[model samples]
Target: MNGFTGELIGTAILIVFGVGCGANSNLKGAYGKGSSWLYLCLCWGFAVAFGVYAAGQFGADGHLNPAITLGFAAFGFFPWSKVGAYLLGQFIGAFIGALIVIIQYWPHFQIAKGKDDGNVINIFATAPAIRNPLFNFLGELIATFTFTFVLLNLGDFTQGLKPLVVGFLITVVGQGLGGTTGFALNPARDLSPRLAYALLPIPNKTSADWAYAWVPIFGPIVGGILAGGLQYLLH
Candidate 1:
């Protein structure tokens, strides 16, 4: 497969597992309902690992997150020419993945709807636990900065067992820093799925919370850029 196809498929896989977990945890009548935060973090981490493996197997760099792609391109770690293709694939794939989750948890959504669960939006996107815009943005920025900086040191994270290491990184980040803002460290991961939640038909859906959307989109991008810039200067 080519880079575009690889990224699309990989991101789709990521969403399948990650958002599916969200559905399971939040939606009523699911076996995994009300799972712990650690469970959610681990599942998301493994989702990322499998996504990276799939992307690498299909001949792409496995940047399922636009922040990473743009940051690397800005610092010359990745080619500028491929940034558009990667971003397109990531966003489109994220939407597809979210749709799959909706289908998979359709019954659960209906059950929740019957009980008037009005905040199902969290199943598709991140939300601040405290609703502080500035602090929430900074939370994402600091978390993503730490994530990207460690990722830069990994070099070729898709190779060998590095994907597992990447997964571990995600888990630790979520565990340590995810409480305040749900750790939306990737714009494509947060925005595309949130958009899907907004546009798609789902029972008991709430507002897409577009008011706070900018935090995830710009925070991760800025964080990634700063991490890449620091790495570039050090090198």
Candidate 2:
């Protein structure tokens, strides 16, 4: 009910949807991916919208992503002193979500993946559609900008239509840009699940791809700030 609680609970649900899709895809005899691209995208959008609806009044950043928080903080919407708390809360929530997901999909991990292939196991974390950092960064920047811009405009109390726009915008990003970077538009989306990947007892798991971790964390931060700055300049 408090700020941290809202963030923690909301983040867990958000990861559940995202990670649940990944686990469902690999279930034995599950056929080709149980969910489609569009389904997942809009699912993500509503996930945040609903999460915020519940937690927004509770004082949670409803941030789901560090970049948005940091972006707003850079513009003075969030407090510098509290960013750490928000990040910590988000990370903890992500860990719990990923753990729940892994438990929920234990059977599939044993069956479809045969407990091999770190790549298969990592859908719970995230992987890039393309390994190139340049394109990956570009995708994140563009996606974050689109999402953040929508948020800024819809933020005013006088305009009650922002939530729909943000939700729709999230769907758009997932449909268009999610194929790259698995669309880690949210830092919590990446880092929290990642910590789970590191600790979960899956048969085979990779290094969490630390070599490229910076891309998601910084890319969204950059994109969010750029979006906020542009909005500030324009209005």
Candidate 3:
């Protein structure tokens, strides 16, 4: 497959598992409901691994996240000409993946809505455990900085180990820094899914939380740019 198609499918796969796990844990009546945080972390890590594997052969280097694509492009690893296509594919794929999760856990969504414990948007997107925007933005920025930094350097050490390295990187970040903002290291991964949660007709859904949306999107872009600039300077 080409770069666009590869990124599309790869990101779809990532969200299918990533958001799927959240739904499994949060939505009532799901078999895996109440699963531990570690379980979610592992599932997301595996999702990244499998996403990279899915798009490994493509030209875009399996950049299922917009930050990765932009960072690589800014660092001259990826072509700027393809950035739009990659972003399009990633966002679209994430939306579709989230839609699938909604359908898969339709019954659970209704049940959770009835309970009204809180917003079910967490099942589809990231949120702050605490309500501090400064800390939340910093969390995403630092986490994504680490993410893009390690990703940029991985090419020097191994030829084909990026998938596994990135997967583990995600797990480590999730474990160490995800408590604040759920570690939305990718704009597409967060925003598109959030958009889906807003647009989709899930029963008794919560607000889309647009006020905090820019944190994940702009924070990661800022982090990606910084990481890319760092890599460029180092080279």
Candidate 4:
């Protein structure tokens, strides 16, 4: 398969596990409702690893996250010519993955509506725990910076173990820095899912919160660039 196709399928699978877990945990009457943070952290970690493995199998680098693709391109680790394709694939995959989540949890959505809670959107996207845009942006920036930085540098370690290390890195970042903005280190992960939430007809869900959308998108871009530049200097 081509890089674009690999990225698309890999990211879709990643989002299925990542967003599906969130839906299972947050939506009322779901089997995994009330699951703890550790569960989410572990699932997302495995999600990234699985995505990488799947993408690699199809001859792609398996950068299911746009930020990683951008970071590599900026650092000359990836060809600039392919960045657009990778990004497009990632976003498209995320949208499809989120749609599956909505379908899988359709009944729970109705139960959630009865509660009338405004956080139903949390199943699809990230929101600041503190609701401060400026600080929230910074939180995403720092979290993504840490993620991209570690990802870029992991090549120095054991080649066969990089995927597992990346998974643990995601878990650490989510548990350590995710409290602020839910650690949306990938723009495609946040924006595409948010778009799905906005476009889909889910009752009692909160607005898409477009006001905070830029934080995740732009912050990750800036963070990726910073990571690439830093890696360049260190190398």
Candidate 5:
């Protein structure tokens, strides 16, 4: 497996576990419905760890995130030539993963119809608890900055026990800073699945909230770049 294929499969797995957990917690009639925030965080963390492992095993760098790829490239930690392939893989994989979740939760979606259970879009993307766009953007920036900054120190996070450590970092970040905008630290993780939700036919769906989409798309990229810049300065 080359970079594109590895990234594609890895990101698909990431979305499968992460968004599957979202569907389990948010959709009605699911056994794990109304699960706690910590559960969600842990599941997402594990999702990323496993995705990284898969990507590394398949011969990619295990980014699964455009911000990581771009940030590292900007700082010369990664190659610029591969950015397009990695990004394409990440977006496509996220869309596929979201589709899988929709299919897996189809029954729950049917039962959730007209029930006011929750917005189906949340299963595929993030939304702010409060609808302040500026702060929401800032929240994502800070969170991703912290995440990427620490990740820079890891150096080849896909090796040995580093993936688990990365998972632990995600859990802590979610628990600590996720309350604001659900911590969409990766644009592919947020935007692609959101696009899927908007375009796909899922029952009990609400507005895809395209209005707030810029926060996740631009915020994490900026945050990641800043982290890489700072890392460069320090090193």
Candidate 6:
């Protein structure tokens, strides 16, 4: 019911259901290789929508992503004191949800393609399948930028369309730009899961791919901040 509790619960559910479905499907090769993208985006977006629908009316602010909260804070939509709390809650939720993914999929870790230690962390976080950090970073930046831009355009919470716009923006970006690096648009979405993968017991793991970790964290946050700045200037 409180802000922190609402954010934590919402984010945990989002990561668990959204990332879980897609990542799990990827490991299984169920919808064909990487077929989980669309469903993943939809799940995340719909999750956001539902979370807001339930939590927003209660003055929850419902930022499932730290970047989202930070973006609004930069735009002055969120207060300074509360932004940190929201971020803390988001990460906590992400960490918890990531643990669930690791525990649930421990069995498939050994059998999943690219599951070796070489890309172990990649499962929890993200990486460029093609090894080109330039394009990978660019893809993530653009997607987050697009999401932020739309958020700004939606304006104040006069109608509740803001949340829907945010969801739609993410869904579109995932469709258009997700191919390169799976679009790690939210920091918690990647880092939390990556941490779980690094800690979870798995056989024949390669390296956890820690080298490519920061991109997801910094890229989306920067994108959100820049979008907030740009929106401020335009107004």
TM-score ranking, high to low: 5, 1, 3, 4, 2, 6
lDDT (10s digit) by residue, model 2, range 122-208: 466556777898888888888888778777776641125544565677778888877887677888888778767777786544466
- Best-to-worst ranking by lDDT: 5, 1, 3, 4, 2, 6
In model 5, the runs with Cα more than 4 Å from the true position are none
TM-score of model 5 relative to the true fold? 0.97
Candidate 4: residue 57 Cα off by (Å): 1.0
* RMSD in angstroms between candidate 4 and the native structure over all alpha carbons: 2.0
User: Which whole-number lDDT from 0 to 100 does residue 36 have in model 3?
Assistant: 90
User: How well is each residue in 83-162 modelled by candidate 3, as lDDT tens digits?
Assistant: 88889889998998899988888877777754354337788788899989998898899989888898887773223776
1 Cα displacement, candidate 3 (Å): 7.5
Query: Model 3: how far is 203 from its true place, Å?
Result: 1.1
TM-score of each: 0.97, 0.86, 0.94, 0.93, 0.97, 0.83
Give the Cα lDDT of each candidate: 0.90, 0.71, 0.84, 0.83, 0.91, 0.70
- Provide the clashing-pair count of each candidate structure: 0, 0, 0, 0, 0, 7
Candidate 1 displacement at residue 206 in angstroms: 1.3
lDDT of 5 by residue, 183-228 (tens): 9899999999999988987776888889999999999999999999
lDDT score for residue 186 of model 6: 86
Q: Candidate 3: deviation at residue 85, Å?
A: 1.0
**Model 6 worst lDDT window (10 residues):** 113-122
